[model samples]
Target: MTARSWPQTAPDSKDWVRDAIEASGDLVYDWDLTADRIEWVGLASGFFGTGDELVPDSGRMLASHIHPEDLPQRLKALTEHFNQHAPYDCEYRLRLQSGEECWVHDRGAVKLGEGGDPERLIGTLRMINARKQHEARLERLASFDDLTGHFNKLRLRDSIDLCLKESYEANVTSAFLVIGVDNLSKVNNAFGYQAGDQVLIAIGQHLDHILRSSDTVGRIGADRFGVLLPRCSDIQMNRAAERILQAVREMSIPVDPARVHVTVSIGGLVFPNPEHMTAEDIVTRAETALRQAKRDGRDRFTLYQASQQQNLLHRRSQTIVTEVERAIAENRLCFAFQPVVDAVTHQPVSYECLIRLKSASGELVPAAAFVPVVEQLGLVRQMDRHVLELAAAELAIHPTVELAVNLSGLTAADPTWFRALKLLLQDRPEMARRLIFEITETTALQDVEETARFIQQLKDLGCRLSLDDFGAGYTSFRHLQALNFDIVKIDGSFIRNLRDNPEHQLFVRNLLGMADAFGLKTVAECVETGEDAGFLANEGVHYLQGYYFGRPSLERPWLAGSQPVATLPALKSGAKKAGAA
Candidate 1:
């Protein structure tokens, strides 16, 4: 068709249309149906290159530029539009002149002839490269963790579901495994959180590299990772978990001038009966196995055994519940005091009241034996109040003797326990001043905001606070700012080799320095020899507690009208420290 045969237009209107399409950043095209000729009006030349010769057939010319993968879809859409005069709205990749690719949204409709046959096709193409790139990035973010480059929780769950479905169809077994970094918090406490992040990144890379290609690894928790293996058998699953654990055990991560090592506690669940099992059930079982591994001892892998559902651990948990309920009923719950003595004077500054369980035979049970059982039974809050009541009673009689009572994380998480504690100290104002509540670092980190409020309430009641196991969990400088405690008890794990391990010494020194700057007193726990005590004293520890000082006794040393240091026997000559021994 000649320019004159085209639809009527004012003089210079074609020029105006060309200018408008160029300014709008659109590529305009016209395909003549009958004549089989093509014409490009706007920046089409700018993208396809200006000097290119015009081809008679638009489809042939466009085919050369359209990406091969997008060619079929574009052709199908074009064919429908040509046959039935359908609207064309599609996105496809276009190869530019510089051999780079660009995404564009193509939109238009067919212009019909008088005979009702298709005569021409016109369309506008706008570059959507940026939008496509943005969408790709968002897809990646939704599927993977930014720091560790592992699958995110949502993606991991979906992948596990897919694998389960596939395994069910094939009548095959699949496995889910989880690994928890045992001392990540301690690493964060000793070094910085950045160092902790580095360690996690290293671990993720290691797992991704070492695991089989069929397995998917993901970051499941703050210091935990999950692995999904398809078509895996029981033996294969156990071997995979062990291999990962061994690999993690031997890893030496660098913090600075010194290197820090870490170990993993792994749990694995292999499908025993695939029928009626969901992804969540698999994950739960794997987590249970992981917890058992950590409880038994970290740096190992535990496979979830179906038989264990009726095993001793479960029976023991039930027995503990029964025994604890009986003790509370018979008033057999009691407290034993372990003194925290002044570093220099060796006089007991405060007595840590430990909860003891007295049997029907009048034998006292150790805290370690029953404390975990009580916590698991969800009776920790009750135990906390029991300790609070006994400690308050002791404080009431001995006004000068200060008592430090342990509070579990379960107790700290509950507001009712705090209320009970307040009620106990309501009438005895002097007793509140003499009471010190010790909360573990793990417990405080569990719910920082709630624990902070709890700490403030107790502090307002004239009671002091001590953060027990200071270096054990992930106690960062941020925690120090979040909650103010009067005392920081150096974890016995570090104090065990304080004199022999330079690394331990450095950590304790750093902790002491930080605590001192915050106006918090430091206590060295498990100081079992004169040498350890002397080292702690030189390092400016305010208090020391251990067998070297005094063991937890049912009888209070202060009640005997004698100072703890005077009554306690001195360290035996040439006797190794408790840690050394």
Candidate 2:
């Protein structure tokens, strides 16, 4: 009876073992050292989980699981071991479960015949997928801020360095604007956490309202917004800071209206070119100025100053603020006309009405010099309203010459603006043909599909549309393709030295060619010199404007001696003067 009891094994015991592992839905394998055979089964095999099958001849089977990165050396060692009739050991990656990837650890040895021939190799495979995935998730969480979806403080340090390098390579300067909510603590204390959150989100919305889309704004600290402005100047940064402060002031953020109202203080540092100062220095200056704003009285803006900057830092800022108010009050904001020549005509097809401010000192400042502050304070729409009235009056005077005026994103969509426009156009039906309203590519893009409707409405009203500063911010050639714009103003940056810079000159040529294809007209702005003007004229710029053509001024009136439907001066007469002075 004992002799009759013998265990029955399959003819190919190896295949049977593999099939069993597969049936169990586990990765399986087998190795026969004496036969130099290595067999693996199933799509998801791991070393430690199925080590038993790989026993007796595990070396070759385990080697298949080794990561390709480590497989070379591991395989060589295993092969050497086999040649010497020693132990078998190896590890590598194996594809698994519908192409999912998994890292594994495999280890084992080979059993040999008494004649020194390898018979079988066996091992175990362990799955490391969960641990690896956990590590990756932690890395992502470490890099991102949970609230604003901005980069976290830890990531900011790393990102700023890269930003600096990129800015330098692009020959662009970087500026930092540090914003702190002045009334945040008050809100959190008087109201509640929810109110504070509402206020923060509102600030973010308004900040986005004022900044260029390319700029980066991050919530690196509680109740703080840190913005990085690339390819910017001190003038640009300070103006943006002012706008940020102004936006916070105007936002009617629904937060326990009875509780403390939220406001923000802004301070900015423009990194000096040539030196490309350390990041710490930039932060230090900006923080110092922010502290000064808090000390001076919250809800204001300031520019960072060095030791040589003096008390005049605060004084100079106050003076500028006072000057802006005065300009707005005295109707010192004026318009200058720049001719937009038809690329084919090479003659004045129309005149663009530009705004400028005259300092109390009699020096004239460009709109870029102050419009940023106006826009930030929620005053730009008012300013735009005033300008439109003035433009209409000018159109009446220059009935035949076309007059193009700009509108801000918020102003163009104001429901009442159309009515106001109609009133301004009441007497001059001829002005319709002579009137073209221009908006920045950015404003045009704010609500692309919606904006198109507004633009078409303007056209329906018989007003022409010119998309200004086509490549200034977010507007691209694609916008030209998608939306209807009669006129496209090439960014002044490319036209500033069209004669000397081959790349820029080529840019103008390419842009003109593209505009021709789109049936859109081209205009050259900031044409400062004869060479630049001549080059652009040759490059097919229909019209040119800059110091060479004329500088902006309120006294200049509208182009072609147009009648003033109304003027900034008239608007100022109605508004109260600033209380600051």
Candidate 3:
């Protein structure tokens, strides 16, 4: 009985559907291919910001409202869908009746006639202004630096790459310059970081203002900016550098309480033929020149010109870099162990693991030969990792042998190196206890707090830490107190001829006194003669490491029959013998 009395169906369901679409701010249209007419439903006026009387009723009229720059893309999408039965999807901008522009997303499918030719296009159009704005912001962030609103390092490099390609094809020359703010740290310390940021922003704007329209400026470092000039000659580059220096010199940025007066140093390089050079190479050469400018004194310019000898040195450095990289890849990176002998016993206490690269010709390359190059090329991190791995392997094989490994200045602040160390010793914590990590005093003094934290991290991991090259840098008593080092290796310069050099003798004596006061063990390095070794042992040095003790050998000294002959022959009459206190 209830079914018989069912309510009548709605008069038309299409009206409700249209109303729903209108409420959602989407408009549907049926575009006739033959008549070139359009039948629109839903809120067309609201979507296009046009009054009801001005709503487009034809395909041509609708296209006229689209932004001229975006019309071609919409036309291309339409042609593809009409001819190939492809789905039509386009996002474009529309110039509304109010003279304001808005983004819109149009999606549709082509309907076919009896012969399968395009008959009509059934589509939906929705406003996408917000989404387009978000996409635009993301694009800007990816290509520009937030601090200075200029091209970021990545984008600047990409632009340089494009310019290089074009220049090579067209036979044009360009110049690149690196500009560094002199003593920005002093500004930060005196005027505060906000003032520093203001100074940086002002400097960036000044660079942009003073440079040519074709030139590009980018903030590459906290106190450094890079400029690229197209179609520039050596003379033009020099002029540009001088102009930049003058502009910065004239700038007196007001930092609230104080008007900060600052100067800049400029280094520039001209690329007459950049066929074999890369953006990285260009930047590095420019930075090298900048360093020279700073060294020459702040507020100056230095143009990098490679001399014949300099070119040869550069080629050699390149060859060494390539060799080191290949050696690492081919597993030819190894360690040579030199014993750090007991001061009294002259017996092996721990072997210092020195990094060595085996060349393709079977010649072992010393660290001094390639390390500086590696450090300069930003590849020392990789070398340091290889050294760590080799040291770890040795420790694993000889559980009883204590090994000391050196850390580069860069590695002292590298969190990644510490991570790798943790990964290697995570499962074998005992290995850390026997590990001695040697960080040079110069490296430790670079960022004393950071180095102190690194030292504490190693100590926490049960690794013994040593301050290598002690007395080589300006290490104050305060620094010695801050850094918790287990041993201090006196710089070899002071110990090389300790018995004869009275000044060095007094210096080593003071260093020894400082070590004694701190309750730290001491290792005297560069003890090449019996007198030096005897003097060091007499002065209460805890260890001796040098040619007189044992030269670094590729053979594992801890293994049976591989132990190095560490002899301290003919002690002085007043000096103690090996093993005698």
Candidate 4:
């Protein structure tokens, strides 16, 4: 059949083609490459928002309506199709007659004439504005923070890496700064989290306004931001940090009924030789400086200065973190049971489970040697979970022995930890009853409502709660009343020399009085001498724990022939006191 008669052979065939093109929302075009003239069909006038009078009849006229930035892309796609016989497919922005821009997907095939030279082109243009808008939203989410509309952590790190590469190649200097919000927790506690969020957003805006156009800012943490400055030197970084500090300090952010004043501590590093540094290294150094700034006092800036002592400490912390991680993965994390004895009887009542890492050399590393580093590195949650698992397993094996396990502040506030507790105690009322969980006063006060809820949850599961390190944080009587704990362990400092120090004696008496009023059991920690132990028992302390009782031992104290406590000279002294009475 001839091409001209083919349409006539099928009734209403032209109508069907036109309906399909209009239904698909695509405008079809036929272009005569030699003449550069174009013929449009299928909603050309409606698609371009123009009638026949302004309809583009040639490629050159159509190019005028294409967005300037997108015209090059369209030309490149067409050239590829014409020269290499490739299928033309390009997405670009098109300007409508109303001056509104919309995304369009342009695809076509080149129809070649004799001698294989391109003579005609047929293509379809579909408005993909909705799809492009969705894609743009997704891209924004990927590269920018939702809260601040600044670069996200991943993108910020990538930008830092790119800057480092460029700086190294050009043999120039660059800087990275970490700014931490001061006392944000206090703001959250005082005015609620919504107000805290407003403070963060306001701080981000302030940073954006203060930094130069070449600098990049990102929300790298909940209350921390990272700034990357390209082509920056030491003096430039110091000046930039001062500007950021001054800007944030002078601004008052509105949070509804209340206005909040905020300040930030900045730590920065100027890397003249970026070739040897990674993004992580740079960030760590800057954060280190930031910590020093915070230590010197908030609302200040500190530039990183390399010191042998600081580097050694950093290396040691890194080594300990690596070793702790390895120890956790290899099941080398274990507990040493330190006996908490009846203050009067010197008989083991329960043991506090202290965490210890069994090194490759088989030496037990004390928690003091590594716990601070672990907590600083944000690995305490995992460490706390491991300690819980060990404590639970031990409780299962020793039914009669009650054990107390310490919980970190981070773990105490974690919902997952509560969930884990529920799972471990499920259908095991006996195990729960024998388990005791200890949290310091500072930990409980970190988020009092949350900690109270956590304590109640533990109590509901039949586990006893202890307020560890009672006087260390100068906890108020109201906080003590709010947190429902089964026991209150006096801070070790107050108990160290109870017999020798009258001040410590008075403090202990008052603490015991408060514990008595609350109907809480009292345990005096660091009872290292018989005289101190005797004084505590006479004062009605419920338990005593320290080197004088027995150091933390790896051997299960409940097992046969295990001496959990030293031969208590305090017991003999107590008998003498009773005889004197």
Q: In the order shown, what is each candidate's alpha-carbon RMSD?
A: 19.1, 25.9, 14.4, 16.4
Runs in model 3 deviating more than 4 A are 1-244, 247-260, 270-284, 294-297, 413-415, 446-460, 478-486, 514-519, 563-581
Candidate 2 lDDT for residue 506: 74
| Per-residue C-alpha lDDT of model 1 across residues 406-492, encoded as one tens digit per residue | 887656645566678878878877888898888888777864655786788789889999998888887877789889898898888
How well is each residue in 60-125 modelled by candidate 2, as lDDT tens digits? 544454446877866775677778755555444664434455665556676777887667766555
* lDDT of residue 543 for candidate 3: 96
> How accurate locally is residue 468 in candidate 4, as Cα lDDT from 0 to 100?
88
- My TM-score estimates for the predictions, one after another, are 0.49, 0.41, 0.58, 0.55
Strongest candidate by TM-score: 3
Score candidate 2 by lDDT: 0.65
> Backbone clashes per model, in order?
0, 33, 1, 0
Residue-level lDDT of model 4, residues 228-272, one tens digit each, is 999998999899989988888899999878898989999999875
Candidate 4, residue 517: how far the Cα is off, in Å: 4.2
lDDT of 3 by residue, 218-301 (tens): 876667888999988889999999998898888899997979889999998888563366676688789889999999888999
Superpose all Cα atoms of candidate 4 onto the true structure and report the RMSD in Å to 1 decimal. 16.4
Candidate 1 vs candidate 4: which has greater lDDT?
A: 4
Off by over 4 Å in 4: 1-244, 252-264, 268-291, 294-298, 413-418, 445-460, 563-581
